[model samples]
Target chain A: MSAEGDEAIQRLIALMARLPGLGPRSARRAVLQLVKKKGALLLPLAEAMREVAETARECVNCGNIATRDLCEICADPKRRTGQICVVEDVADLWAMERAQVFRGRYHVLGGTLSALDAVGPEELRIPRLVERVREEEASEIILALAATIDGQTTAHYIADQLPGTSVTSLAQGVPVGGELDYLDDGTITAALKARRAL
Target chain B: MSAEGDEAIQRLIALMARLPGLGPRSARRAVLQLVKKKGALLLPLAEAMREVAETARECVNCGNIATRDLCEICADPKRRTGQICVVEDVADLWAMERAQVFRGRYHVLGGTLSALDAVGPEELRIPRLVERVREEEASEIILALAATIDGQTTAHYIADQLPGTSVTSLAQGVPVGGELDYLDDGTITAALKARRAL
Candidate 1:
């Protein structure tokens, strides 16, 4: 390859390496495969990226991504079930959707409050979530956050803000299909303490 | 997300899954990350993909990818060292370049001969390689193919085509930093058979 071509490929590899799962070595292999299957994989991916880049936007109501001011879930009148699921990020919102159980709206906080990083409610969408809860007249708010300190702190803060609305959290116990031997001591204790009739 | 946004993201994920080393699950994660960091990763990657898609091409002389008629290694006047390294694909050529050794030009065969797949010399760049050897007055040809049955058969076939030039192959032995305990029986036997004094 010419110097220019090498530079272009190198630039591409560098960019691909920044992706979530791919590293430099795998990125190179991906680029090679893309080049080999130019019409099938590379060109289509490029077009998709361009399209998404031009159209994808954050929803003004929920912080979920959409091609318009409001995301699909927010726009759907049927989804407004007077229940809002609060999550840390859009990925979490997508995960909830994948479960196909949640029929209500969502509020993506972008991230949890981190005092060490100087992140506050202003940095996240906490204020927006509070405003939505009141304006939308939500009856209940489900905090589907991670089992981390920051996640718990954010959940408590949101609960404190919504005095009239009922706020609950997802159950914490052994994961379904998980083996007892694989679970940690804390999870075992929690599961034993929360034991109920099966 | 809205229906349109979901469609675009789903399309991007499907395309990303087609790349080597990426599966449907990982592709979904990657697409989410790309959307989340649009300005930092997604847009720039789209631009790079477009640039490479428009400029990258194959070297007519050696079957290597380049932005021009001839690849950089073939175009370099100093690389005409009367030795051409024949490889199975452009990935191998790039790997050799990454090693920063082997200063000679290369001939990418696209693929090796496969009896089961109905592939033969005509399907590869065998005839082109013969012409290159004669035209360039090459004194040696190094076969850096995989240590597979089909790869060996292709190497022998190429060697038979050029009687005057001295043909060699990459050493088949334990890989660098590879433990003897982890090597297969065949590799250990080959290494023992080809043992030499240090």
Candidate 2:
């Protein structure tokens, strides 16, 4: 294989290896399977990869990914109200929607503030979130951050920043260190309903 | 939403719904996610999908899907060794290699001949397989087919077709009605090397 061919394959392997649960061996197996199923699966996936790589951009307002400059959620006039549900990541936003309980827009913090990792408000999208509240005139902010120490610290920092805004949080249904992806829709719904003012 | 928006979402939902274990609700969630990630993950995936849909073709001889008319395995001189281990599907062929066992070549029999579905050798690549055996002057034909009733029936049919050649089969260690995906690598290697003559 040419260096280019080998590099393309290697680039794919490295990216795949970074996925949540995949390792080098599993990534190789998956790549091989995709190659064999290229007619039905791989080629299309590659095309999708290239297109996303070219067109995908982060939502400037809400931190969600968007094809356009602004994400659909931030652009949609109907979704913008006083209420903004704050989440740690895009996956959490998806989990919340799966519950079919929330009718409000989302504010993805991207990640929590971690002293261990030297992650600050800037790294967590908190500054952008503050701008969203001020510009959009958001009435209420729902903190759906994880129950971990870093998550709590980040939430506290955000709440302090927007002291004038109503702040509530998802209630006691989530287990410690439980990622939103692992929770079923019903659990998410129940947690949203039981949310208390912070 | 406009008709175009609904239609695009609907097409995506349908494809996601057809995935192995996803339901309509999950598909909808997934599509919404794709839309949200369009700039990052969705557009690329769609472009990849379109490309795959356009370029993928199945190997006419062995039923293996490929980028061209013949799969790499079927076309490679290093692969053909007068020994073809028949498998129920592409997944089975992959599982065999995860163990790093099989070295010759593979014939993916799309599926077993089932009386209930009215499937027969004519529906599978059995005819092409017979022709390959004769033309390749196969000395040994190994059946790594599944253990379902239909699998056994197909095996018997193939054994009869290549009566002149030495016919060996994967051993009886496979649990009844079990797909090869669920088996461990050690078990598959043991099964392949200790394969008994029919």
Candidate 3:
């Protein structure tokens, strides 16, 4: 509230501080970094931000984000391997795709089912997912959910709903304390390859 | 030619991949994160980006960025404390300010004067800083540049410019293989307090 504080920079810093790994000071630094590289990076990133701001939408069928009604993976005819990799969120979907090994599609659950916060199936895309499976005649549903209790609970629920459908999960790749974003492509690839029935 | 690519998302991903520490994969996840947090953080950050896109300018005096012709630090009349803390970039200046210790003004050099990249004194804020030393009638000039080779080279050049003016360098509270942006406020405070005369 001092006369010395710069409001605009402060706003930028506050927003950036909320990013997953960045804190206040690092946020300030990141904003400054973007400012410095404005010519090549910042300006373009700014434009992309605007475009995404206008266009980003949820994939109607799978709950992954898309500019269109259906996400690219969902829309792609080549991607229907009769399988759907169910993830806790879009980041997980992107993480699986980043490995470049998954030829199937994805269903982002939006978030894990949590009783602590009272999050339930209706709050997520679970209903839409069962609908997708019925419509797509999916053979397998891969539970790529995190190893957390909530994730496991969500997985079991989804598997139970799809009675005859086989459920599988990525294997032996996620390091302890490592987020999906940090895992290399090769590890994700190996995990996807060695996936076991759940 | 694959059906799984969202053009806009792909473009965003491509652009983000080119950034310093981010790659294509990380960019995808980051974009997803932005999308998920759009209502809370991304929208406001977008607005800030637009504002900065239109209004952000470089401080002619120190090469630090501002939303106006002069940055807040440079615009303040009472901040001219005779001592100008010279830094390699705005991140350094912000880091100094976050410590809430440097009462003096700052002169962001934009970058270290580098001959290897054909960077000259004019490319940096050297000329303006020299002009400032005379204009501001500064007593002690503190070189808070990084300990990198280029940073030291720039520091020496600045020291040589003002023959009679007293100059000093920040003490080694700065860690080896450390960046100013990464240091905690406490470390910055300690470094400034233990500053030694060059």
List candidate 3 stretches off by more than 4 Å.
A1-5, A98-104, A139-142, A164-198, B1-5, B17-25, B147-152, B171-198
TM-score of 1: 0.86
lDDT tens digits, residue span B40-71, model 3: 76678778766665677788777667767787
Best by lDDT: 1
Q: Write the per-residue lDDT of candidate 2 for residues A1-198, one digit (tens) a residue.
A: 111113344455455444334566555455545555655656545554454455556788787766678866767787647799999987677678767788788888888999889998888888888888898799899999898888889888899999789999898688787777668878888889998888
Docking class of 1: medium
Candidate that beats the other on DockQ, 1 or 3, i.e. the better one: 1
Give the 10-residue window scoring lowest on summed lDDT in candidate 1 chain B.
B189-198
Which residue runs of candidate 2 sit more than 4 Å off their true CA positions?
Answer: A1-55, A98-104, A172-176, A180-194, B1-18, B21-56, B66-70, B97-103
lDDT of 3 by residue, A1-198 (tens): 232236776777687677555666556656776666667766777777778878898888888777889877777788766788888877677667767788888888888799999999999889988998888889999888786678878988898888888888877886654566567889888888888987
Question: Of models 1 and 2, which has the larger DockQ?
Answer: 1
Per model, the share of native interface contacts recovered reads 0.63, 0.13, 0.34
- Measured against the true chain A, the candidates' chain A TM-scores are 0.85, 0.89, 0.87
Checking candidate 3 for backbone clashes, the offending pairs are: none
